[model samples]
Target: MSPLQKIGAFGAALAVSFGAAYGVGALVGPFDSGSKSEAKQSAHQGAGHQEADAESETEGAASPVVPAGLQVTEGGYSLDLATTALVADRAGEVRFTVRGKDGAPVTSYRVEHEKELHLIVASRDLTEYRHLHPTRAADGTWSAPVTLEEAGSYRVFADFTPAGAAKNLTLGSDLTVTGAYAARQAPEPVREVTVDGYTVRLDGELVAGKGSELGFTVSRAGRPVALEPYLGANGHLVALRTGDLAYLHVHPHDDKAGATKVAFTADVPSTGSYRLFLDFKADGKVRTAAFTAGTDQHAHG
Candidate 1:
């Protein structure tokens, strides 16, 4: 079995445990021994499960705007992209709406992850950044106004968990800003170092000074492993700067078929190295993969 597969299996087990616990709690709610301590413990356990579910559901509660219901046509959700032209423009408001599986309007929902709906928007070149939440409208749509000063390819991520769901979901799509600007260059390659138990490969090339992508891969026992979902997703990645560990939470690009392969894109603020900790599920357990890489200085035309 590969690392990625292990991650998936671990996630599946966790989901089952959560479901079982939830079922038992619900069943035992009505028929209890009537002991005060037992009752209190039960209540506490119930609340803990709810809190866990909520936390799992809102793991990616930060990013650009994402369309509601982003699953694949077969029943999964997806972030739909309408355009890809990068240009400069004033911070204008963007409109969004959420519809149910049956195409009915959905309104008046709870905030699962952290905020009601976390919206993160950043240029593809990794220069601009904006985090905002859209206001819920009566028509079942969420709308938010934004302003941008640079022009480049941008990605909007919608981080939210539907009410009553156990896990959080993230949807991504591409957007383009139009205007005149200088395209930043990619960074130079830096030495690779290992952390924890997994081997990570880093590509330190930068697209712009502050905007760049770091590539990573995980392996064990000289073989690639399939990574499972840690919190309803393939893997969890957190990036922190060397000085203060300036925190940046990221998710895998997509799901993998086996354990050996995984990938991610990270944005940095300047030409420097950063520490990364990747949490992946494997062998029915969760493990942390770590690595460090320095940034290069190369502008994109």
Candidate 2:
């Protein structure tokens, strides 16, 4: 069976486990704060009526569902790109607007992680990725300078929260960079990768439908390196499912300064290969390290 199919089977088990009371967060996870809230509601509406059980739910045992970034329109918000095509290997600006359900551009937004909106663009093959903060205009349009190094299809994700909204949302759109395209094979799973003279090692296990803690340690010349804050955390992580590029924007649970290791809680939707990008600030410079990893090998059929 395919990984997705196995995930579907797990989804069924979840449905049965939470039957008649609440919903499973869809076959794939929805990457929005709203979904997390819904999951909490479901946990509260549990089958066990004991006071201890309810207290445990209140203490925040809410499972993190698989995140959602597979669609352009979600929860009445749409990622409307001004232009879907870009010239490869050329420096240029990418523009877009978030339209509300009333079919109008949304101007007001709630800042999350010190940014009004986070824009992530990645090649279809997961070989190239960019995390950018775009400039929003008075008319609700946002502009960001981007230079895609290669010509290929790309996915542009707009992750933000509207003003007074209860939860966050991540919407995705397609971008086509015109030119000769040659796809590169996705990299194999590796625990460590070096970028810009710094080596980062990953430690964790990803199980389908289960939340896991991922730790990343940075070092230089065999000595642990202290990390600076980036995006309100020691580091930031972006995980994309290899085949469909389902996106997850994760922030570390701890952000102690001078710490060499940063940790994040990740719960992917399915059992499959994924590409992870770690963006960290060190010595006043931001560098990104990429790694390819798969879910628990034992989970695969």
Candidate 3:
């Protein structure tokens, strides 16, 4: 067989092995049952007394689901960082792994958004942000080259789907950079930002608990610049809540390429200040425009 064909065969076999192992619950649809079981467990509250259990069930149904990326360990998955501290002067290696409930590094993961895993790092003050993917070794240790010039606390998030999990998981851990540090205040609310000679404007407000309508237009040198599709979409947006750096991956709803404007709906978990990074491709290069944004909760004095 040709080398390319052999590689394709190997990848197919790998995917089949993972899916077959994880597809066990397919008989009774255990994946579906897991959700129902959680709801039942939350409502059951034991067989002792029915009075408080009944009342608690109503409250449980009304409560919102806990947002992702707020915890380092959840649902039997943990983000294990090899080193939590980094020197701030030069390029350094960041190493980590995703350990499953079996207390071993996870070697199999279903690809999402064309990648097996995604790593996000951002300053606590919302000034610096990076979207990176690390290379995984046979031992499942993932490492990437990272640089942080400024000294401050940062949030490192791991987003991925385990071979057995039915849904994507986002976990975050704290990263400390050692040095003298001063934080920049979240920039005043602004609808527009400029980067790499590209001028982009934001339209719409973020409403807590509902998908907020957001729109962006791109221009350059006094004329509208044609936008090319990047990441299978006209544009990509990453919104980080100011305080905890809660991560939200918002994709453009419109798919037409070469259009200057892109639209998205972002359902923020809460009302707060958020920093948005919009990445768009033009002139054969991708550029990012950053904006400081506030939700409806901050609209009133």
The model with the greatest TM-score is: 2
* Stronger candidate by lDDT (2 vs 3): 2
> What are the per-residue Cα lDDT tens digits for candidate 1 across 215-265?
455666567657654444466554333332233455445566564555544
Candidate 1: list runs displaced more than 4 Å.
1-75, 78-87, 186-301
Instruction: Return whichever of 1 and 2 wins on lDDT.
Output: 2
186-264 in candidate 2: lDDT tens per residue? 7655667777788888776656555556778899999999998765668877777777787766556656879999876
lDDT of 1 at 90: 72
Worst 10 residues of 1 by lDDT: 18-27
Selected candidate, larger TM-score, 1 vs 3: 3
- Scanning candidate 3 in windows of ten residues, the lowest lDDT window is 14-23
Q: Candidate 2 regions off by >4 Å?
A: 1-67, 297-301
lDDT of 1 at 147: 70
Looking at model 2, how many pairs of residues clash?
3
Model 2 clash pairs are 29-66, 30-68, 31-68
lDDT of 3: 0.60
The TM-scores, one per candidate, come to: 0.40, 0.77, 0.75
In terms of lDDT, the poorest run of 10 residues in model 2 is 15-24
RMSD of 2: 11.0
The lDDT leader among the candidates is: 2
> What are the runs in model 3 whose C-alpha is more than 4 Å off?
1-64, 298-301
